[model samples]
Target: MTTDEAREFARSYVRFLESMHELAGRGEGNEVVRRVQEHVGEEGRRHSVVGRGFAPFEQVNVQVALDRWSEQPERTVVVEGVTLPPHYGPVTLQQLLHGEALPPTRLTAPELVDLPSGPGRTTACVRNGLFLVDDEARGRFVLFARAPQPHQGEPVLQLELAGLPTDEAQKVLRELDELRTRHNVYRGQTVELAPEMHGGLSVVFPELPATERADVVLPDAVLARIERHAIGIADRREALRAAGRHLKRGLLLYGPPGTGKTHTTRYLVQHLAGATVLMLSGRSLQLVGAVTQLARELQPAAIVLEDVDLVAEDRGFGPGSSPVLFELLDAMDGAAADADLLFLLTTNRADLLEEALAARPGRVDVAVEIGLPDSDARRRLLDVYARGLRLEVSDATQDDAIERMAGVTASFVKELLRRAVLEALEGEAAPDGVVVKDEHLIRALDDLLDSAQGLTRALLGVRDGAAAPGGGPEPHPHTRQAYASSLSFVAEAGPGLQPWR
Candidate 1:
């Protein structure tokens, strides 16, 4: 810059140092504030400061960047116990250094907060800390991370570069940005977002169920269709990009509740090894705009919205009028076509989404129905759920149970298997082995089909069959077959029992 600009910049730098000292002087007994001033005094000989702020959800990434930047040669002196009021709102480095008044001071040391670095894991992050660093690359600079004081209006993870020239500060920030991106804690991790204080988001690395393709109880063609839309594209993203195909596509899984939509999603998530997975459901779906931005940044990403019908309560509404649902569609449409992003949405009431999907046509490119499991799928679900159990039952008994389980959901099958185990252990003593027998399966099926289980059946997503759970006469009761509790068979049945693998 010109000499005039340099002089003004230097003057600004001097004023910044004076502001910090003034802040220190206000808190006489606060050792932390005094140390902060002392460090600035030493480092501000010929330096200035630059600052940047990140979303509160990025606390984990900020901590990661700091840790990586401060590795070896560059040591960090963490000031602890520094606190900011929930109402305090500061943006610039100078404003942050110039905290509230003296006596009842807001200084002790910088605060530290625990943030999730990975699923079921967390790293202690510097919250409002004055980190005195001796950087081997960019030399000494003070840094501050604005904490998770959600009440502090629009509170963000503020990071500043103090004690450096303007140009140097910019370069350091760029480096930190690179580090944050390269070693992001959120990358390749499964995160679930929820609304925190005000409208900010709380990002947590949830240990989503690690479902496998074999474990997914869906028609092979349907499963393959979903994979081709999501995983298939993600796997061949480069080739698609080369062939002028847009990677920012959407997949809609529409079905009744308990139809394995979520289970199928888990399978897709597990298969996409390096893709960042962002899952939202219920009220969380309201924060789609902000989440879409994150998805854009973390490409090769999957955005899963479970049961989106919860937000689109008013169906048959005009285009661009349904606020929440339209916002969701708009967010999907906002994504860059070339971005390797997949929007995976699940909904039990596909009718509710018809208008919104129509408004934003290309947003949902592939729509698949995760309908009631057929006989084959039901049998496979039984096998899947019984994988851990020692099931020794006759072929006739197995057929009877499967035949009676028509129109039931995957959840029903899962619960049925569990109930069968309980039935086996009901009155039996520990004989040579504890095996699930014909009697147990029969009894459990009978109990599940009992009239008293109407609500339970509805909860398990049982459409029809027995009493139609909803107490309404649904056409095609059982949808295909019926819920039969009268399977007259003996526990021994002449010893034609086969052990299930």
Candidate 2:
């Protein structure tokens, strides 16, 4: 009885142990399967040796580069993380691998990135997903992320080349560089960089028609010099090089406001249609280095810096002057003489420009002063602006009227013609079609002569204290009354009351 009982208990114990072992084996197998899945996932591939190495902070640029590199959607691989910048909060590895949508807790503060040819203050989020960036270097690129995880120390980014050979990868990189250089991001575009963000610039392609050379009010001598130095040099690059002349040239167009400085620049831009043109002003001066680099890469390029006095302001003036002045000077000087780069800078306050910039040999080889248009030039400007309209006045009367507009700026003339057209349209005598009559111009001049428009006229390049053809500044009724009262007070007070006191 004892032996049988003992044997039954032993058998039961062995059965229990076998069941436990089977359960443990299943759990171990499940654990192994999970590990395998994690390893083969997108996140796992990001850390693999084949992945292109990049910093996590450079995810945007990397995405752009990769998107541009490969057109095939399947071959492109991306990984994202918030690890490199240090300020971004931690993102768990699990959240990344599972293709989980980043929760509000994981998102870093949104950043304002200046977009090319778009509205101001576009927001960029630091999260896990695919992102598109219009880069200055690359036209546009896609930042792709499958499952991105937070990392320690210096974060790394890797692009998986798939089965691409070393030679092919190199060829692709070369092609990418060439593509970036060949297709200009800022050609025929106006752009400004975001002062708040590093390396953030926005571009706007202006659909501006090419201004005719004859349309500009600049002197033919000034235009000729500019054409020869800037446009002509590019055209005769090989000849100039053979003649021991370098293609890199800097020309400064300085003049009072409302002159034809900018107009001349536009003509040059149009003249060099095949050349890359990069226009920068205001905040965009910060990107001078980048602009120069691109210009060098894309030879036969023109970089126009409007209101350059904002940067090249006299260092002695005071604090808050742009630090970019030195950078600009260096860029101009550093560029290779044979690069076929033209720097066309315009400024209303050229007198205030630093001597180092204005007088420097290579910085500004030619300083062309686009002064206020004289009588003949002013007449031409009027004629150009007044084109496509039937004038009520005869040629003789028009010439007389234009002569009377002497001392008025080119800007003033253009504005005057525009106002005249507007007046004609609004007038009861105005025909159904747009026809500008002599009375319309006279009325516009009368409006300009009003004391209220004195400041505006001055701003439009009219000389201060200059009288219009109709008359001097016409004081308002209230002002006339005040003047009369003051005169009376002065007379009544006599010597007893000092007006100064």
Q: Best candidate per TM-score, number?
A: 1
Q: What residue runs in model 1 are displaced by over 4 Å at the alpha carbon?
A: 1-50, 72-81, 85-92, 96-103, 133-141, 162-167, 194-203, 313-324, 467-501
Relative to the unseen true structure, what is the C-alpha lDDT of residue 54 in candidate 2, on a scale of 0 to 100? 40
**Which residues of candidate 2, in runs, are more than 4 Å off?**
1-65, 72-179, 182-200, 313-322, 429-432, 469-501
Model 1 score (lDDT): 0.72
Clashing pairs in 2: 51-158, 51-159, 52-158, 52-159, 54-157, 64-141
| TM-score of each model, in listed order | 0.77, 0.65
Instruction: Please name the candidate that would achieve the greatest lDDT relative to the true structure.
Output: 1
lDDT, candidate 2, at 68: 57
Clashes of 1: 5
- Quote the positional error of residue 26 for candidate 2 in Å: 28
RMSD of each: 12.8, 15.1
In model 2, the Cα lDDT at residue 159 comes to 38
